[model samples]
Target chain A: MDFTIILQAGIASGTVLLFATLGELFSERAGVLNLGVEGMMLIGAMTAFSTTIATGNPWIGVLAAMLFAGLISQIHAFIVITLQADQVVSGLSLTFLGTGISLVLGEGLSKAGTVSLLPNFSIPLLTLIPIIGKIFFTDQSILVYIGYLLVPLSWYYINHTRPGLHLRAIGEYPSAADALGISVFRQRYFYVFVGGMLAGLAGATISLAVSPGWFSELTTGGQGWIAIGLVIFAQWDPIRAAVGAYAFGALRRLILDIQGPVLLLGFANPFYYNPYLGFFLQMLPYLFTVVVLVIGSREAMRKRIGAPAALGNPYVRGERGK
Target chain B: MKKFLQSEWMSRLIDALLPVFATLAALIIGAVMLLFLGVNPIVAYKALWDGAFGSGNAFAETLVKATPLLLVGLGICISFRGDVINIGGEGQMIIGGILATWIGLTFTGLPGWLAITLALLAGFLGGAIWGGIPGYLKAYFNVNEILSTVMMNAIAVQIMNFMMRGPMLDPIQAAKASKIPQTARLIEAFRLARWSPTRLHLGVLIAVILAILVYILLWRTTLGYRIRAVGMNPLASRYAGIKVPRYIVMSLLLSGAFAGLAGAIQVYGVNYRMITDGSASGFTGNAGFNGIVAALFGQLHPLWSIPASILFGALLVGANQMQRVVQVPSALITALNGLVVVFVVSSEFLRRRRQRQRLAHAKMDDAPPDKTSQPAEASA
Candidate 1:
């Protein structure tokens, strides 16, 4: 029950959430709410695992996962962007489609023993900074290191870059952006694809790096839904999303580990004595998501901050009121 | 031929047949998937068709499967019509089942009819509570109902797992080495009335009746009108003094109530005791999701959902037989269901485009100076 060990595993698992939350953030910021994160993640995990098994290369597996998930996302983009369908229903269907396709294709891949995993290494000097280095820079997966780079890079991209501003403009005011010669439809499609690729990356992170296997739907569990919840909690900011993802990842690790000990704080652990009680413990992540949503909603009310203005609305050129 | 294609009757015909085309397109894609799986698509489909409609008993089983879908679809009709998407059907159904099972188990001595009625009411109440929380959040706090409902589903799954393996585990089963997570057999007197030599029960009749009731509630009643009006445009409905938030909450509540009722019927009629395989879909058979497909196929009309449910129910029932006959995974039906939803929703744009074109054509003929007609093609 070393606290440092829990935090280390937490950071690794949190990378998975980081990818998913950031992906969803990009989609929602672009004014298209793609709720197909769960489905896309499943597709990613299946593709990554199956490809790694066949190709003997985890890097290729990761790329295939991202491409396949991104490709699947086009169905959603076409429906919501080009056809002007309800984003919610179309996204839900995408999830069903992704899950079904993966389940059918990844049917027996669960028993396909093991494959080469993504490289894990520690930074030379950073690992000497006591507690911070041990937890942050210790022997972690390459994807985890990439996650470290992505958070700051994403924050800078969305806030400082000209393209970032265009992304924001199209999401907040598509008509105005369209008038400025930025194709709202094209940008929306691209952002949605970016979201899907990130979601796929998150899935690949799980099967190839983090937990390193597929157990069907349980591979992602409800982490995709949690990432969606985190996006709201993060106020669509990459920094805030990263903080929330790491905290949630730690909480998940705590729940899983808490059940293993026979004694806790000088008393018997009820979870250990009665394994059924662990079911309630497993519910913490989902229940916490609901709680976080309430807090996010209330805070947004108090602060008067909110989602992108045009979020969830299909942007049609010449349409009134955008 | 162009003029004939543009005729009003032809447009009406196309509108009516759009869903059929979408379904056919999905099945075609499914056939391709079957081909990739190294199975003969025609033989597999024939086996599916025979399994679904081959015998009287099979048809009866299909009806039995349709019972839950129809019940859940009825709820989807109400919620979606109100513009409040209720993805919490799985959780709501589980909560409803827990309540209904508790009542049936506790009141074994009560009169059969009264016990059944009370259990059903309890189920409805449980689902309403589960659904109303998200509805209230969405209305007042501006929380996204989709995310909250999904979280609620996960929460509900844990609760169900807890109750089944702990409090609800049958005493006899608990003593065995393989302690299967299930409840005590619901008293025989309280079980749904089954038909002779068939699994069909009174639950089917109740589902059919409720569909008509939901139809009337949505179209013929003031309450129904307000729900639909709010769905169409909440701001306008609010300005018209419709109490927009209340209708939103009511729609979700009613929707959840229907799914809850389905849960009760499933225990009382089909299984006679609630059971679980440590997963939400294992207990629900994914009816909560399939019901959405049924409702969409029905054009969000409750009455239409009757046939839609039966159709999907046939697919589900026949998939089992197809799995056995062709060695193809039953997961194909789920994928096909997703494809249908995608196609059906995508086709809506085509329908709207056609309607807009017709209006533009009519205005051009009626009033040559109209300005709106010029931009119609550009917009399309």
Candidate 2:
């Protein structure tokens, strides 16, 4: 195996999942589980693709993607918070709505040629470091660095800041937080919106940083769902979530890498059918997520790991007291 | 008694009209969006209507499309009534199709009636097993059903893809063929014959009968009572000595069975073969999610699910016609469906607001004049 290439691909895939999962961690830790990540990402991908094509600036495209995704998430917040609708259903609906809207809006723009890819940034002196520098810093897009930096920043914000404390409190027990005069609705919406923006940014990273172009349906290929699962595996910690993303990303790369060899062993002349094997191999992360979830929820594992106390529960101010 | 009758009738009228109002509001908003896109909203809607239900053929197509939807919606109604959201209907449907296909292929020489029956049974069992796994997990271990079911759906899709590509590939097709993955067609005799030139088949009748069966089961049986009691309040049911977990699991299994049967009927009655994509294209299990809308719009009652499913089925059928006439994307149909779900779910909030308003009005009516005057003066 070419360790350098494998490492680079791993980092790239990790950046995609990390950006989205980190955003989910923010929303989930704030006590609202936004299942609309996939939808937001889909919208973001379309927005970035369209904006980049129209303006010829990748950064503007990235901004457009985040705004578009965030705007859609506002609808999610409206349903879950303002209307007191079921968050799960609302989030799922947002996804379905976003996917449909993006696909419709994106259909025309999908045929446009690729924009100029985001230029990579290399830190001075850091570029000289051996395998680590090459894998992480050298020739990587700005979004990649930003995605990695978010892990620690999110961790610090969630654990070390007062707003973080309030966020966690609202998620754990909104009524208690309300008694303390925290605006539960405001916090939930705030985090959900912020999470949406991050998710959008993560999505734009795909079109601008990685694929650097437009693509149609399933372009994100269930990465958003994988990010949701990663939040659980990370146990609501941003830094850990990043690690989980990277691990899954690496696993994805490993599966693709072994596809040829494995298929060759199972069937003669596997090179002829490597593409089919690769397609099936792409499903590894999702299958792995189910396995992990099943194992993680086992009695032994449950003792060690816990979900956010208020995950998926809708918070109605007065109802909480009862 | 006269006043009570008037108020009751008024409330019933409002109940009937609320969904229509909600749907109109959603379409108006959607039209405004179309206008922003530089599309003529009126023309687009006309096309959608024409394409979906303008002619006998279009209406038949709509009914054909609605068959799976009606079945899946009824299935979703069953699960939702138990307060368990089984979003994995698409997956369950796919598994049902796979099992039915497997049975049809293996028992090809059997009499037509027996083969059809066996295929349908296999489908139900397949779907039931798929749906039951998540239910069991939730009942036995308190695992979140939403996550489990969603995960299962993803897994099921992958498995379907794998099966079509590998073990279940038709022998006639060369291994190298790039044709879409699908099972062999069921025997002609086993297939549901069209009643006329229209594509509508026996599936619609079966769907209606099943909906009625569901209503009877939910309203008449001891099992139904336990399911409802568990749904209304699991803690209360447990305290009342109901096997809450068992009922929860049973509801999900029954829901899955219905969904699976829908898939089988689609394979035998319509498609005649299991396709790689199981109904994301309005062919099979989009009906599953649509069933959620039907269940909610019907207020989670089986009796209501029939008309609700039909209404949605019409919308779906109409949307296709609208697309052809209006030059708008058919994807708008899904958007409309999402809008319906959003509106229906949000309607509860509107109901609560009205209730609160009524309560405040009643409080003012009950207040003594002097006391009311003093409170009013304080407020002023």
The C-alpha TM-scores of every prediction are 0.97, 0.92
Native-referenced Cα lDDT, model 1? 0.92
Which window of 10 residues has the lowest lDDT sum in candidate 2 chain B?
B277-286
Please list the C-alpha lDDT of all candidates, in the order they appear.
0.92, 0.79
In candidate 2, what are the lDDT values of residues A1-322, reduced to their tens digit?
A: 4666666777877888998998888888777878889889988988988888889888898899888898888887888877877887787777778777877788766668768778888877887889888888777788888887888888898899999999889888888998999998898888888889888987898888876666655678678877887777777888778888888877877676654443444465453446455556655676677666665566435576577777777787678352
lDDT (10s digit) by residue, model 1, range B57-95: 889989999988999999999999999999888988899
On a 0 to 100 scale, what is the lDDT of residue B289 in model 2? 70
Model 1 chain A scores worst on lDDT over the 10 consecutive residues at A269-278
Q: Give one digit per residue, the lDDT tens place, for model 2 in B219-311.
A: 899998888889899999999999999998998998888888988989888888876752233336477677777777777877787777777
Positional deviation of residue B268's Cα in model 2 after best superposition, in angstroms: 0.6
Q: Supply candidate 2's per-residue lDDT for A319.
A: 80
